[model samples]
Target chain A: MRARLLRFGPDALGKAGVVGSGRLYAAVAAGGFRRYATYRAATLAGVFTNTVFGVILAYTYIALWDERPHLGGYDQSQALTYVWLGQALLTTMCVMGTGFEEELIERIRTGDIAIDLYRPADLQLWWLAQDLGRALFQLLGRGLIPFVLGAWLFDLSLPASPLTWLAFLVAVALGVLVSYSFRFLVALAAFWLMDGAGITQMAWLAGVFCSGMVLPLNVFPGVLGEVVRALPWAALIQAPADVLMGEADLLGTFAFQAGWAVALLGAGRLLQVVATRRVVVQGG
Target chain B: MDSHSHSHSQVDGSFDESHDSFSNNSFNESFIELDGVEKVFDVRKKTGFMRSERREVRAVDSISFRVARGEMVGYIGPNGAGKSTTIKMLTGILTPSGGRLRVAGIDPSRERTRLARRIGVVFGQRTTLWWDLPLIDSYKLMHRMYRIPDARYRENLDRCVELLELADLLDVPVRQLSLGQRMRGDIAAALLHDPEVLYLDEPTIGLDVISKARVREFLRDLNAERGTTVLLTTHDLQDIEQLCSRVMVIDHGRLMYDGPLTGLHEVGDSERTLVVDLERELPPVEVPSARVVRVEGPRQWLAFPASESAAPLVARIAAEYPLVDLSVREPDIEAVIAKMLHSMRDTPKPPPEQAERSGRAAS
Candidate 1:
């Protein structure tokens, strides 16, 4: 046992070293970060538009409900909170535009993917890490800041417990993982289909409608709502919002999120492996 | 006598064995290997939702070559001749339909990451450097990506700046630099990791003569000093002539010729032109071993096989005419290559000026 452990130690360390050495993840992270810095003006405009849209959505909900007891187990305050949360998470989760898929297609067309293939890190994992970094920056710069400002102006419900906050944090992290894996799977379509943009747009549309970004999943018809809740898309946004509102049990909510994360990430990995094999066979 | 004969046979056997080993070693040391590689692309036409039209285009058909360690090989072909397709396969950007490829001792398709670590590449028309940042910042970012040690990074940066003459351009953003400056900086960025192999696709495609000379000089020095095997694909024959001793010419997805540069000139039966200026108007004269191409005022021009000795033709013309001035021009490589490509039909004639000179020279 000791010998085996000793042998495995160096190999594991070496693998980690390789990942850190910028073969895949580091290059992508650098690229994504640089891209964000360059597109600062555009990001600011996107944030402004998103915040204004959130306020309009909150006002529209207020007119419909008008302090009437509650609709779909959410009061006016909770409804307003949901609106702000959805707006913030929209940017963080990249609900409007799954840009990574387009990036992958362009990379494929231009043969830039060759640079990524040579890296010592898994391409999927590298892209996920870079996306995660971008999400973090956007969530802070575009998502969280805008939401806080909007909430202060609109009198939205804030979470009451540190436990709820902690749960919300975990949910958001898992949400990003699940969301990125799903997007990556869509991006891998470039290997098989020549114009992957149409399919990518459809995937983003599905996420927007089903993930409760434009409206809460509970508003869907009974059977459709049930189906939507069970899907990974809802878990990326709705589950985090539920946790923040104290409407979900911490352990149960996280357990479901974990399940979705594992399943989606596994699916992504399988698709990536198969897509890469096709690329090798077809010379994409 | 029997013992002597046996010893001689033994020596010959060992020589053969060593020669075989040497050939195998040469192939093994190559950074890239394409063995009977074939890539056939399916050309499809999609019309609304119906079944699409399908046509087959053999982009890279049964091409094979080896780029040895530190050997700067140029892969050139006309447009749509599968140069990019072949490059894509070598870099693991695309896969071959049939045949095997190994890059940097790894099957590029199977062990892409391992191969990537051993090679650095740059596409001339595209900017891989960050568009917004200064060239130095981009280099620093690449340093982080490749995880170069700080000391080694500094040393390589210093050397690249000195060799590429990039000291003045480092502070400028890539978007701001002139094409020549940007190209030099881009090449430096690709070399930061000290990759054992470098692939440059059209590195001098669009540059002033001085810039082209600087790039060629840098590439030549880098190859000689570092032994970093290079695979360059360019439309510029001047680049190939000056930098590459060996040339591989591909046409219509097939390797037409792969040998020394001299072999290119030898493959086709072409002719060199000799222009002679006489002190007086010259009458056309019939001469053996040469064709009289044209006659103008005081000048006469003639064409002879490039393989034919210039001395004999020059001596013949001088003995017959009062020669005031004389010069010899070798046929352009572009014309030669074009002729070789289109030789199945009538070859395209040289430019009018060249034709006039050749006509006058031949007459």
Candidate 2:
């Protein structure tokens, strides 16, 4: 990026830099990172809450897994690991919180989205970059510490190989993509509905149950298990945890996550086009 | 004559970038052209708790005008007069429902992102700066977001900082800055990319006298030196008086008057207030062709036609009453627009003498 600064001319600042530009998105992502990093108090509070929840959920899972050994094809250690992973990922996936969608919805309500549209960048890509940065920061600031604490205190299944860790990281990234795309679509609903608070609540409810955050989708009964596992929300926590536990085929889980990410992102782009076509920014 | 004819041709003809030099040929091409552009919003009203009625509100009704390159024009209107709607359509935030609208040979809605590269907008009511970050951080984000050259970005930032007097406020977070300071910061952010045209919506709305003067002076220099086309929407007539050569007035989503500032006063039948301080409290000043609107202790305000000279009224008042001191105040643009809209509402078509007065004033 600094190399481009040396070649100073009008050509260096041309429209070509805006189309499929890596540096532009990276800079926006960094901006998002810096923006979230400013809320030191919020990060500390979030990390504390996640650690408390991890302890509570780990004990519950230990009790249940002990009653039924090898339940849902998982031993006691796997169930406990799933519980800790779910707690760690609660904020990173933004399943319960409104996340960036809260601010986006407010912007639409106040007609401040007009300023966002006045920028010389793709709207979807700009927000996607911001969400990716936010997810990464939350992962480090809120996700890692709680999981490390939980693993130290409890008997948990730890990944034995580096390759599995690498695959887990990739799955986690794709998980963020799927979740962001879904949230982006929900945020765009504010354009037509003029208020998306109700829709956001419904989305959060679905995410909590279907993402295997409260309990592993693997333990659900016949039809419910299959249905929850097939949902895009499952890609956020269940699939990533499964990859880390080395209980799922790497290629198969990735394909599922990648497919949902592409489909949801494509739908979001379409909705964005339609929504911006006749934008009715709420207030004058 | 050559400039006027060329501008006319540029508006009527297809998009042409041949006369793109902004400095040398200021009026040789039309930078912004609108032909009967309109915007209608479908607003729903809750007639009852479980029922509603959808109504189509025509916010911008077939407004058409052309702005030449390097021209600083004032767009003044009432709160709901569709001035903002027009500006939004021009910026591509709201798509026009009918007719053609072009800014620098590009349809704003069709090529919004492309056009965003060339135009800058400032809404005085809202600050675009990052609230949590320092003032300069927002500019850094824009620097990369717009892909501005490092040298040019630094040059423009330095120039804005120096000219806008933002040297001390650069490190302050936006949420902590006062309204006037944040406004100056926003103006600087808009200019960092060196856009060719700027749209300022009430840039002086909440500014103090000194800050307003600073902003107006900076804008004047920016226009004069860079030949940047500026479309200003302000309720303060002084902004138009000091900066713009022409003004357009909109009322009820229609263009009511488009001519020189003085012409608008004549056409709208606006009034000027004459404030006089008498030696003691009097009943009222008796004068023909003027009415006392307000009277306080030892002071009185009289309203007279703006087109009439204050000399005769002053002489008459001095001869009849004990006048200590006096000054005449010009009517504000809002009052002018309100009076214009009120008169137009009374008579669908303008009276002959009013038309003749406007015609003479236009010349």
Candidate 3:
């Protein structure tokens, strides 16, 4: 059996018009994007809510900066960038899988996971491809619009150097990896927990709190700030935010983001193995 | 083999009197083989608040059989009788606890992903298509997922759509389709890969009569022309009568009967009745081959072995008795199954050596 798979697996795939894994990944990613597009109303609603929150947070941070000079070592420009960029990064750093995480949970709970296992694609990579598509769409649809609104309305400062902008892009991509691996792990917990809601809520709460999504990590005094900086959650938000604000060195931020991406993705793969073996594929 | 007889007129076709037995020694050539395959599930039940008890449910118990290529076989039993479990094992969805199982000479559980390329499976109760996506989108996705050659995928898709009348449904979301429509969609999704083995679990479960007939016809053609080996699990007797040449009955994870569908009557020792109406009250009819078991005022009932032809006895009765009206009633497959299960309890278990030789348990 293994010999046949080794011999004809890729051969058959090509004959069947797969051409390569590139095509398969492209197809899955396209499916994810198209599926999200089907819910146009929901996407718009999410963007509206994000914009309202972005505007409100920007004003609130501006007011706080008026009261003090460099609170948490961030001046008015850096603080305003944190609020607006953080709003743009909200959907991208989906550590909870709210958008696509339900798919894994539903499949596991309903025994539809059986069909998932039957596919030739690796499960983690399949999901990662899907999130990558969603992230790209979010970046354009939700991320770009709100950031532009903040810049035009509040006179937000743009990154001065082309190098910093390039580093920010790299940081954002790595941040996706960190968030996706963690969401994948949270989703797989459905096999053991039987319900992913609790885990999902807890994961996102910890992620939002520690990643400086609501409040900048600099505001947290002493060891607490250092602790949040060391964790992978910071890579999801603070790393990208820092690169955009020029608060941290571009290389250091990219290194931490890149390191966590590889580590968490590897850990996610190991957890998936355990989940498959212990699978109690639910229902008929 | 002729140990029992019956006369069921409702049956559409005569049972294949000759057996298409698969011998143990010829296992090397068979398309599917299961030697003492067993699956035990560990189920935990709540004993009380904050307390639970663990138990084991043997879904497939030491089942052994072989299905030669192009053979359409029926795998059936009452609910919880392990019919689904056996199919799950064959598909490698659930690993068996013991024994050996092979499909196309490959161990299913150990190399399931590899073996998936060679097999197709449909569970009627579930939807394999993306529920919110249009039917064609699901098919297109499966086209990539299975890596089906573009030309072959198109050919199969066009054929299935034409035959299954799914041309109008391509743009509809699966959740909007009727049960029968969804089932047809699911079946087509499984076949897009052009698998050598097709395992259908209750393909006709919730379909209307016309839909059921359509599904049965499509399957018949699929097996005849493509020679796709099918293992069907269904509760509808007509499905078995119309499609499967061989029927296997399992109860409590034990196979009780394994042979032609008509042979079920003989195994169960069930009887078929002939109802006769007379002009007036009369004494029991005298007959050599059949005995009158009931005498209504103007109606008499004759019970005979269900496997035998009613022709001879009908001829003899016409020659001597006053017959106003008559009709032959076929024994229900459910009744035959009940009687078979009941009789099994009265007889001692056949020695394993003897049972294995026959390729069926005296279950």
Cα RMSDs, all models: 9.2, 6.5, 6.4
- On TM-score, the stronger of 1 and 2 is 2
Instruction: Answer with 1 or 3, whichever has the higher DockQ.
Output: 3
Whole-model lDDT, candidate 1?
0.73
Task: Choose the strongest candidate by lDDT.
Answer: 2
In candidate 3, stretches whose alpha carbon ends up further than 4 angstroms from where it belongs are A1-19, A160-163, B1-28, B42-55, B269-339, B348-363
Relative to the true structure, candidate 2 reaches a TM of 0.88
Q: What TM-score would each prediction reach against the true structure?
A: 0.79, 0.88, 0.83
Task: List the lowest-lDDT window of 10 residues for candidate 1 chain B.
Answer: B1-10
Arranged by lDDT, best first: 2, 3, 1
- In angstroms and one decimal each, the interface RMSD of every candidate reads 5.7, 5.6, 3.3
Q: Count steric clashes of candidate 2.
A: 0
For A98-177, candidate 1 gives per-residue lDDT tens digits of 55667877776555665556443467766776787678777777787679878888878888779788889889998888
In model 3, pairs of residues that clash are A16-B148, A16-B149, B5-B305, B5-B306, B5-B307, B6-B305, B6-B306, B6-B307, B6-B308, B7-B306
Evaluation by lDDT, superior candidate among 2 and 3: 2
* Docking model 2 quality class: acceptable
lDDT of each: 0.73, 0.84, 0.79
Model 1, span B1-363: residue lDDT tens? 232233234434433443444446645555566667888777687866987887667777776676678888877766666787787777765668898777765666554555655678877876667666678878876676666778988998999999889999887777889998899998998888899888898899789999999999999999999998888888776788789977776666766556555555555456778888989986875688788799988887888776677998788878977878999988666665665545422335433543343233222
Residue-by-residue lDDT tens digits, candidate 2, B264-343: 67666899999999999999888889999999999999999988999999999999899999999989888887876666
The DockQ assigned to candidate 2 is 0.39
TM-score of 3: 0.83
